[model samples]
Target: MRLNRGLPAVASSLLLALPLALAGCTSFGEGSEEPAAASATPTEVEAAPIEWSDCDAQIQPLIEGQPGSERDLLFECGRTEVPISYDEPAGATLPLFLVRATPAGQTERIGSLVVNPGGPGGSGADAAIGLALTLPQDVLGRFDIVGFDPRGVGLSTPVDCIPAELKDRVIASEPRPTTAEQLDDVFALSREMADGCAEEYGDALGTFNTVDTARDMEQLRKSLGDEQLTYLGYSYGTTLGSTYAELFPDRVRAMVLDAAVDPDTDVVADAEASAAGFEAGFDAFAENCKGLIAGCPLGDDPRRFLEELLAQAGGAPVPSSEEGETRQATPGVVLTAVQAALYDTASWPQLAQGLRAARDGDAKALFSLADELTGRLEDNSYSNLLDANLAVNCADTDEVVEETEVRRLVAEWSQAYPLFGAGSAAGLFTCSVWDAERTPVPERDAAGSAPILVVGNQGDPVTPLPGAVDMAEDLESGVLLTWQGQGHTAYPKTDCITAAVNAYLIDLVAPQDGLTCPA
Candidate 1:
């Protein structure tokens, strides 16, 4: 339910999305210079190797496993201060935390592979650890796997704009506000979130946009001592990476963007597309459930069960069964849990279990899923995920769809996409109330960049297939690789996708354009 303006972060393969309050306004804060340099070449800088330290402490909190277990590569953590607004490189700066999983034993070097796991708010530091453990040996052998928390995310002096209480209200708010009273509440909440974040962050809120993040990438490249940038971006990471290619196309040696975000879609368009995607993904989940033997947790009709639960939850939240758990499975929370499952088919079975539990009057499973997707912490505190998600999403776009327009879309889309559209249409208002300075994400051709590989999964619920298609079409040298697979991203899933991506990152060889791999 986090009505973000841009695409949500990935949770399973690193993207997570939820309903969170977000807004936009203008101006770089005091001591600001100008926005990031858009010229293809980076500013003159001497090579400065990253100062590394033990990262096990920072990375352990985000993953599962015994403490300090020996692994292929011990992660080394570090940070570099980058301008809060590139317009003022020496002005107020934020520490961009980085984690490097030094390859176990190197063969031939292909430079560092800078990886971003899609959150515009997701933790690249965490992704580096996970990928270090699981990325193909071939990729590891040829490159140093490095990931950084984009400014205002995770360890990067995260954006903590909204108060904890307000964030809870935002999460628990209605998913589909039908009546005038309900709709008004939505607007009021939007205003509250926007005003609060603006008051809290001031002009610095405007600096969290993607273009600036791309500029930060350039700074990171120079700091890493790489002559050229090699990158692997997933989901929204594709957006950031593409912006990098567009800005510093010549600085790029190679890039692989999986589960691409369309460079051209606006807030409303993205929400509508999300509705259609989730609906399709749900259908697939339902169809798969039908094929299971006697153990299909969802009985005869999955959609009906979901609708009934949602309708019931709108009036009274379902109670969770976990011994000390207090969070109720309200319609917004319930829908978020369902949407979370749609990200990966691997989660569908768990989704079924959660639904069955809800039907049986014990909804902790559903509540837990929602908690995870929204980055709710075990201590009942939330991560800065939603706050940063809002800041970046709102900062990236300049569009301002009015309340009336959002109402119209909700009315039309609800009937068109029964389960997901109505609520998602409300996302359009997320940025409308925002008063922050906006830097619109540019449509890119990435002219003169090295061949960039763009991969798409047919069943990705968050960033749909068309985003990849549009991304490939948008890049001058982009090559398209399609996977008839199910999940939020297509990478290291099947041998075909892995080999192609590895080859590209390793040898700068791209799979044939329009290449398709069977699921």
Candidate 2:
């Protein structure tokens, strides 16, 4: 949500199994050394054209048993090579995966409309395939909906650092470590995960930064035979879209950024803001929970109740068993469950149910919610979301806070934001000991880009509304479209927002700036 470097499980779980919120790739700062002339522009040499093929065998099952026309949708998959680092176009390359969906019955097409959901690690190719099944028919008829996995993400060659078992252990660890030894153990695990990535990836890890991914997007644009880019990005995807606008503003035809990440917030500030935001969201949920059902699970004071529960879990995790596997529901696990539910208001009821069950000494419901957030399947396999999230995030920044500073922040944040403060603070050290060199991209105004539509949700816990406000104002030609609603991004959630977005993408008609659509 905040696009912070640490807290992969919290961030990735925000849009679990939902490609609509996948993030795009982009650089956040300039390279340590001046870029070679070659890096300034892609090589003139033509990359091989994509050879699209029927992907029905692999993609169709994802939508199997679903109702309506989506069942018959067709998808084409392809891959293209881009230089791992733009500085040396003739050097080693990486494969970028693509999934394209063309209108089933339309002859005249408007152009390509690329979509990114937003995990600095989210799979764009997967998002594209999902979009093919659910996007409005008119939108489908006019433009080729494309989803691409940036380098070091799904479908593309991924950064597989920690093994499934190791990752499970890391995620299932306690969130609030009271003792110095507990804290030391947390930091040690972080170091091991980071070191494992470096060992597995080597120098290739350096190329996973957003800048390289932004350049790859440009390559994608060219390969699609599009003269101008028409793009839709959510969450961290906004980072990619904004970076592209900064680097090649003139090439953008139309772009929509929903649930934007503020370009200015540092790691510490981002975590603090995220903690505050989730606290706000939890409060909203608690308020709505009142009177909706008898004997509300969170009780009269949800905040206080949660604090007690977390404290209890911290000392001794509740025992939970699912499918013959037993695990203790630690504070981290409980926090993950709560965070995952906060993503969609519809899940609030489920959260209440889970919490009620946890209170009664049955931890299965909470464990399921935690598994959903962490991508831990029944068989104990993982989706690689957490691995890629850390790989890309750690590679993007070079800020490292000492353990003492982290502990201080945890104390500070706990005072300010009780619900998620300490838990959020615990994630501060994730990128501190990472092995990759940071290639930070400077935040830009994106001065020459065409009018870009920026959408923000009123109740998003991850990418807060203020970040969207900042992002819209920072882009030279950006316009804000506010949704007075609860949830992450606006489009496709409500008819009003969806219609406006469709109109904007199809006709290039910007919504009245600052237009507020009802939830």
Candidate 3:
């Protein structure tokens, strides 16, 4: 799945609305029993404990300075080394970066509660700061929030494939190639990206698979002195969490997986589902914006209007201006802007404004949204998000359809889902030529594990609700919690959902199966 740049509004709002609550008397019982040893040999010599230090210089100052964001100042940063290949514990190792925030005041701490904010590429250390600030006080008091950048992400041993200049060109390339020349260019760029990674990292690229990361998580658990894993994972993070549960079923105390990625979904099915999801989200946005806004940009038929707009951009790229830097908006940029907005309905108003501006021949708003989605900063420097996302995803799955099949799917899906199908299909070639040994997504039954909570949003565009449903059913003890709402994940969307998750994580009382909260 592509990265969803939008943060859950409920989380941000909660952080702004409430001051950090000091810890109080809250006793979490002893941790769960340890599971059977993993298949990989345990290190003969235990790894050194993490050396904690103030992270003021490392954390982003803007987030630290935000109101009610003291946790950023309180966070401690550190690094730990683990074997890049778990099968060879004495072989090459990679350093994993971590950020941890403890409770404000003394309380009976449960243990370190690990978190990953989706991405397979997102900086979990960065996410920990946000999670520390936004999570409810009661929940905050009971657990030490720890976020780690996985083996090939963020501050960890990063996978730098494409250079910034080349990446900019790639992201701005034409999304839906209609002609042979354009298609050739698309294929060339895809190979360029994959080959670049192979050249930079060599065989090490194959070690970034989720299964390896799952082993790294176990090492992290031991390093943190936690008896078992307690986790909160969203979107792609759910994949990591489920993989961990599958690999070490008895190692879990509690886990909350929101906006799940179905392990069973192949690349083609993933593209098709994502296309339908974005179309559904767009339809909902169009219906809600009809009478709510004056001169709705989409008019009566949003589907048709968007299709025409995409076609127009493809033929002659729309010009976009930001802070005097001018660039043309290609179909790729437009689609990225749309996908970013689909993550959270709170951005729907901005999406409307952007679409309206685009219709009026000004693509500034849309370009800004696209820049945000792709992590293009004000200084034009890009993060390694796109790089690591591709690396990890390519390493995880082996399903690769040929360009001809992808083109056929695009043509068929474009007719079925006019808003996003062709563009979604256009993205199918990203991992086609990746040079990593594939690790199939695990079954994630997690039999005999503690009750795991799976939260699903009804109208999630990226990881649709059905994936969550399938994920819940796949896990032996999985409890499904439904949030009848919009957006990518549900925990930070509603009080009802948040309360349910908080209860699960802090109290280990999973919400009833089939529980549904209204939008």
Candidate 4:
């Protein structure tokens, strides 16, 4: 299936409280509000749990037909124009794109449930429309699942920097900046791309960070004519959800942040945690594959196979197909593929199968699996979202280092994770070269919001489970819901999580403090 971030620890950590930017020149969420004339009573609609009647009639038929599967899902795109800078409402205008599924039946809509799938770069508008059929039935029934291409993402006025071939080249390269020249080359290339992105996207690229996106969410909520905003954000989306809750607690109807990031840490810490997570994932793979050598051909010694792959690929890249298309097939790719596979245990067998193919001298299977991990499938073009990923990450984070400093950081991280840390550090080099202005530090606390739910997976590798616990501790109203699961986000993998979250959405039934479930 689709990738969920990575192992329980890292994937979940990144999901917990990651803060990043979005595309679009807009003010961060800030504005004056008039006092309510009177306190409003809770509607009966709010008291009942999610019911079929809650779903908007306008969007049901489209759900019956798988949109992405058919490619027939009509994209109803609209723009929400917001101020370039929230601090200066008139500085400039940035338009955001919104996509919705038409309700299947002819009934008045109840409200909209906005979605953000994460990545600081993930496109919710595409996901909502494309995956409409697969969402939890109760969720679909109650509210119109609305998705928007966050300011700097797909379908929105996007950021285009590096050429597609160049991006692929970079992504396919080894993650290690072993030589000084190699490190310098990495820095120079990233700097050039960052400068190019800013030159192309202009001031809008500078403003696409997470805080602004959170504000955009508020504006979108207002534009939709909803009294309260209900939302589901996964991966980096958890940051968006938490930020919104902090900024506008009173406006929150319900929200579910699956696989959350630690809200209080700097990006350096996030990256470090993510590295550890990958190691955890590798361990999980080793554990599961050890006894199944006949099916899992990386051999019973996971570490040995991983090391051998890295050494071999690092010395000489492997051709992915007979056409001579090549990739390093290093541990990073193996780990990336493994991370993607960990999203659903159902894919464990597939990963094993790919490993078997690689062992047999057919690298195509491994390459194909790695492609899915990096989102570089044969039919799909490289996304500028990767540029946006850097832009927004640089803009929102307090952690930025020069090449020298990055090298030091990478060295330290490598010690912590001998297998994958160096590569991740090298991969994140783009942030150093990005020109987007930094926000200085996490801004959610100053936003002044509510107790948002932060979910974590016990074995999460990317966004470690501790990240969620840490995030919960940071927020005044934050509550922790731990899932003893293996994926990035808990909701998709477990019915228990869905039920708890649905209860929160429909009847304001928050799970008890520190609620947890078994893997």
Q: Please tell me which predicted candidate would have the highest lDDT against the true structure.
A: 1
Q: Model 3: residues >4 Å from true position, as ranges?
A: 4-45, 57-60, 64-67, 70-73, 293-297
TM-score of every model versus the real structure: 0.91, 0.89, 0.89, 0.81
| lDDT per residue (tens digit) for residues 305-386 in model 4 | 7667657766665555546464546544655566666655656777777665664455666666666555453444555456
Clashes (backbone N, CA, C under 3 Å), per candidate, total 22, 18, 0, 53
Q: Mind giving the per-residue lDDT tens digits that candidate 2 earns over 198-294? A: 7766655676778778878888888899999999888888888888888888889999998888788888888877888888889888888876747
lDDT per residue for candidate 3 within 351-427, as digits (tens), equals 88887778678799887777766756666767677888888888777788889887787778878987677767867
- When 1 and 3 are scored with TM-score, the better candidate is 1
| Weakest ten-residue segment in model 3 by summed lDDT | 21-30
Best by TM-score: 1
Q: Which RMSD values do the candidates have, in order?
A: 4.8, 5.2, 7.5, 8.4
lDDT of each: 0.77, 0.74, 0.76, 0.62
lDDT of 1 by residue, 280-322 (tens): 9899999888789866788878999888888888778889878
Error of 1 at 291 (Å): 1.1
Query: Candidate 2, after superposition: displacement of residue 409 in Å?
Result: 0.9
Model 2 local distance difference test score = 0.74
